[model samples]
Target: MDSGGTDIIWNQFILGAALTRAARRVLERDGEEGEEIRFSYADTHAGGGGLPVPALLPVARKALASSAWAAAVGAGDVHPGSWVLAGRLIAALGGLAFEADVNDLDPAAITAAKASREGGWVRFWSHDWFLFLRNRLAMEPRPHFVFIDPPPDDPRGPGYAMDAAILLDTLGLPYMVTYAVDTPGAQPQEAIDQIGRSGLELRGAGLERGVLLGGGAETVVLDILSDLRNLAEVLGGELSVRLPRAPADDYCI
Candidate 1:
């Protein structure tokens, strides 16, 4: 997969779209109950606040210039990171209607995330992501959506843990879990097959630059994939929607 900030840009592009659709559904559902809905979001691998545009690779900078993401570029032309983008997106979609649990093992990342657009709604934590998820299992109100973007090359990383997906599925949570395809230690097919084995219908997109596997209620999955297709149209790139298939079948888009 592409390295440096290029990968981040592409990853956030899909994530932003996914969250937009998912968050809206949360509000709509809770609104029907006449109860105040404060949408909750959890990011397992929330990175730093932003990156200077000039510091990004040529391809990343090109993507920023050519897409709506340029609006995320800050005062110094810094591209906002995932957490910052999530905060901004949520704010625009539903003001003060959301709270986020953004965590990372890197102190620098946590520090940056806390500093970006300070607000009580965005909580920053320094902890192992797997432990974070385990703890969240007991949360009184589970997050409406979880975004998992684990380290791409670590063979023992939590992203490679199929049981994590099973756990989320059991909770009936909507999530977008990303994995890398062109990396040395990445097992893309195994991850897909494992999701099927979990008895969750396969709902994912094979992006030209990344791999995203998502699952949840049927309506939620359709919304996420619809946003992905819209992104493919805008970017003029191939975002192959991987439809549901039997477990152990050859994974294809």
Candidate 2:
């Protein structure tokens, strides 16, 4: 898949909307009233024409409306306000929102987002997400929610493994969710094994998207809740996993 491939996947998977809805349900179940919520999205390829951005906005807005403190921090080129609108809308429903994105966002898009006066609900930054999270987690309060949406990298590339490793190590932190597309070389099972070697267990796996055209276009949702639970047992913390309800037609070879 190329740079714009995520947009296609976004539409096929309905990820943004589904995740937002799931998050809202989780928050409500926890009775998390007006509490600060943090969301970190990696390698976000969202923009004016991006499918995930437009699809996610409404659901996010609804979540923001019901929460006390809700913030979203996206890495890469996602528009801040588009997401912030969701948070702000949610805040209006008796919640609060603080959204921001890394500075490496598209220049034109960033400018447009800035001019939208949606800054009140969001902030943008140009920094490396790994470094940012490492630093922030140390000084800032742990976020209730974290989303990792890395770009579609060659599965054989070291970058994918490195990023996965970092995520596994960082999983002990609050609630976290990540997205990965199905590719030949990028085996989710391999990633799970790697995490397990680090003493983490493989919780469960779910279906994110199914193939619409090609054989390898399917996306699998690997739930690491069991792994997180194992890690927490040794590390001392709480962890959980929630898989999206699988579509009846979602299947892989």
Candidate 3:
């Protein structure tokens, strides 16, 4: 699930891939009728542009029409065939797709996605992810599953508190999967604690560390929800529960 980069942005893609796979299994269990799944990636990068797109696309294409998933991707200078591959994947899985970026994307990217005739099932937007989520929630049921891989807010590097804040606020939703790195003196557990203070329960946490000789520390996945009353009481902050859906199930690549 490594996003092929060291930064947290790359880590988000790793988390996205894991969550997408988990959601796919959950969707498969429902027998594929009257079920709708939406996958969102808040940030986009050239190096890892195609990472998260493939996971949900394959399932979507099999379950739905290519146009159903292709209409949602925004136009941008994404890698060649990125949107088409994504549409094909979504159509195969019979699902819908939505991708947004804080920064605007190249029109050619949007044009390619539209040209593929997947625009009905897929669409792209250039906007803040938090706002997009908020708006979507107002119109639809809480996404059965959500992957929040916002950019990190480390002061030493390119991080954004607003992204974390938005996610923290949205944690009230039923099921969510998020990515946070464990830097020196900065543990993602603290963020989990903060979210707990706001009344959400932390379900579980998984670690994604560098295994190579000289690679950096690992990124951790904090599975959260609004349950586990006893654990929350004992911990005095936020308590994490280990569901049947263990991080190890999809944490590895």
Best by TM-score: 1
lDDT of 1 by residue, 1-253 (tens): 2233444555676566667777777776666544556878888888787765533434443444543344444445567777677767776665336688887888987777777754438777777787887777578688887877775544656345445665675667877666544445444445556555211121224323444434543343444455445444444354554433564455422
TM-score winner between candidates 2 and 3: 2
Sort by TM-score, top down from the best: 1, 2, 3
Model 3 misplaced regions, further than 4 Å: 1-17, 24-29, 32-120, 151-187, 194-253
Query: Considering lDDT, which of the candidate structures 1 and 3 is the better prediction for this target?
Result: 1
TM-score, one value per model: 0.72, 0.43, 0.38
lDDT values of the candidates? 0.59, 0.35, 0.34
lDDT of 3 by residue, 1-253 (tens): 3322222222232233333454355457544466565543222211223323423333332332223223333333332233333334444556545342212134554444454443434335444545444555554444433333333442422133323333534453323333333445434444334333221222223323211000000111232122223323322323433221333324321
Model 2: lDDT to the true structure: 0.35
The candidate that achieves the highest lDDT relative to the unseen native structure: 1
Model 3 residue 50 CA deviation (Å) reads: 4.9
Residue 100, candidate 3: Cα error in Å is 9.8
> What lDDT score goes with residue 117 in model 1?
55
lDDT of 2 at 16: 35
Better of 1 and 2 by TM-score: 1
Ranked candidates, highest lDDT first: 1, 2, 3
Better of 1 and 2 by lDDT: 1
How high is the lDDT of residue 88 in model 1? 72
